[model samples]
Target: MHMIQVVFMTVMVFFVIVTIHEWGHFYFAKRAGILVREFAIGFGPKLFSIKRGETRYTLRLVPAGGFVRMAGEDPELVEVQTGQTVAVRVKDGVVTRIYLDRLDERSNVVRGEVETIDIERKLKLALNADGVIESFDIHPQALMISKGKETQIAPLDRQFGSKTVGQRALAIVAGPVMNFILAFALFAAYFQMAGVPMENPDKLLIGDIVAGMPASKADIKVGDVIDSINGIKIGADSEKMIGIISKSVNVPLTFTVIRDGKPLTSKITPKKDPDTGVGKLGISAAIPSRPVSFGETFTYAGKAMKNMTILIFGGFKKILIGDFKMDDLGGPLRTAQVTSQIAEQGFTQLTSWVAVLSLYLGIFNLLPVPALDGSRLLFLGLEAVRGRPVDPNRESMVHFIGFAMLMLLMLAVTYNDILRLVRGEH
Candidate 1:
């Protein structure tokens, strides 16, 4: 049951985050008059679908990733060639529907062989009907029918590439921007609920004690102000006390604390952390906090967002400089595992975790790597600088190669995650 809950929550979280990211692109594309063909969640075989306006919304089998498909973005053209037979539904000399499949005979449906066609630019078609060549203008809202399914045709004006570079850049970058917005909102919500931490660097007061740790075993409690350790007058310096404790791992140290106007002494030994090799007393510094005002809540949330961004970038810098191991990286599997653990901690912790994940997603997408939003913006920047776009075929090939490499990297990290799980390592 616990595993099931974790799986469900993980799916829900992915759904919400991906939906928001794709919706950002979809919304801006529509506003820029680009025809958004589909707004799909997940990839692979479609499980559910519905058409609204010009866009088809779909849920696919895979939950790992999703995309907002814009017309003209795909390299392959869905076009009718010369000498192909097709059925058309015309209204007042305008072709409103073009069917690529055989349809039941009807007075409104005309059968013809295509002689010349331009559905994208000119929106016109010339066909030979019983040796008589006829030309007809296509309606702006013309539909293409294939396998009995209708999809509106996109003219040149409605294609993504037809838009200005500024519009295209905005549509591309909107996905990552929406992610940052979501992170900010989540952080604000969490701050409103839990209040921001107010820490004092001068005092060596014990605010919280971990269960079964050295301090707890030594009978030290929260609200106890530590006076000194090992005959050293700490003198309100928490860092000095921490230094003393960390250097004395597994070594007994005398701790004197003032509790309720009485000084008491206890001998505690710091335990070594397996991961960081740091000594731990399993106690946190005492900090006082209160609920923030409505305006202050946003201020605190903004600060939190800034701090998280810096931390994420710093971690990336360490990885780039070879200061961090590749095994430290986590993929989707590790994310699910961590999500399960945090969910068990309670709703507040889960909320904070989600906020952090959202922020990471936003920042990662903004990196200047191929097949990502940042790379698309880079191409647009070059286009603006050169006064012309790069060759579409070349650009498409670059993205395809980049995408393949990313998939391989994902598999590698996922394998590492599985190995860690098998070895009983978190």
Candidate 2:
């Protein structure tokens, strides 16, 4: 039962995070006047779809991938009717699509066979090497049965290629930007709901007493709020209290603690911790918690986001330098398993993990790998430098190769995940 909950929570997190990432592209693409034909969550055959404005929003069969299809992003392929072949001829910047099939004059439509029939749609067709149209798809509104007429799906300006480099860059960068924003917002909200820690300046509230430690030996117990240490008033500064204890290491000090509204004094010697080289209290104090102030909440959230980003980059650096084991890398399976475990802990734990995962994803997408936002931005950089775009064919090939490599890597990591699971290594 717990395992099932973990898996469900993990999958839900992925869905929400990926949706937000894709929404970033959709939002900016629309803002840049680019035609987004489809905005889909997941891949393969769609489970459900709805067309609104110019875009078809879809939920697909596979949760591993999602995409935003823009006009001119991929070469368009035209479907041929049964027993029909499509041929295109370009003359003086006009493209003509001729269907070799029988035509019925009475219906003014292509019907059964007639020697060599030409059902002509005369418009501009950009042909690729395969002789299929390089661009354009049939639009429902522009459906035409009339002979020698052209049908247009997208206008020239609405196409992705028609956008300026700056506009395109903005659209490409938006995905990563949105991911970071979501992480920061979630972190802020979590802090606001869970409350923030505020150290008590006037006293130290003992939260835990370590077994066989100096404080425990001295009869110090949990909830013994210390009002003073070594005759010095224990103020709001925890560091100062620690400093006093550190200086008095191996020496006896007087402690004034409040226990259930009663003041009690005791003498104990501070001992040095061999492992940490710090004065040992054998007792842990809990900071007081309070609701976050409006301004401070965001500050805490921003710091959390920043620290997580640094941690991700640091870990990546270590992995690159061989400081981390390759087997330690967790793919989707491990992510799901870990997410499930975190979910079992509580809502706060799961939410914090989501924020951390969001930051990780945002940073990962920004790595300059092909088929990623970072790589696209790199291509834009080349375009900016040369004052023109790179050949689309070459760009497409690079992305294809990159995507293939990524899929293979995911497979390998997934295999590792399964192996670990079988061994009960989670």
What's the count of clashing pairs in each model shown?
Answer: 0, 4
Q: Pick the candidate with the highest TM-score.
A: 1
**Weakest 10 consecutive residues of candidate 1 by summed lDDT:** 196-205
Model number with the top lDDT: 1
Candidate 1 per-residue lDDT, tens place, 62-110, comes to 6666899998898434578899998898999999999887656535788
Residue 185's lDDT within candidate 1 is 90
Q: Write the per-residue lDDT of candidate 2 for residues 173-279, one digit (tens) a residue.
A: 88888889989988988898767776444556776666567888775666577788867777556777778887777888887788889888888888898887767
In Å, residue 351's CA in model 2 sits off its true spot by: 1.8
TM, every model: 0.81, 0.67
Q: What residue runs in model 2 are displaced by over 4 Å at the alpha carbon?
A: 1-7, 44-50, 79-152, 201-288
Task: Assess each prediction's global lDDT (C-alpha) against the native.
Answer: 0.85, 0.74
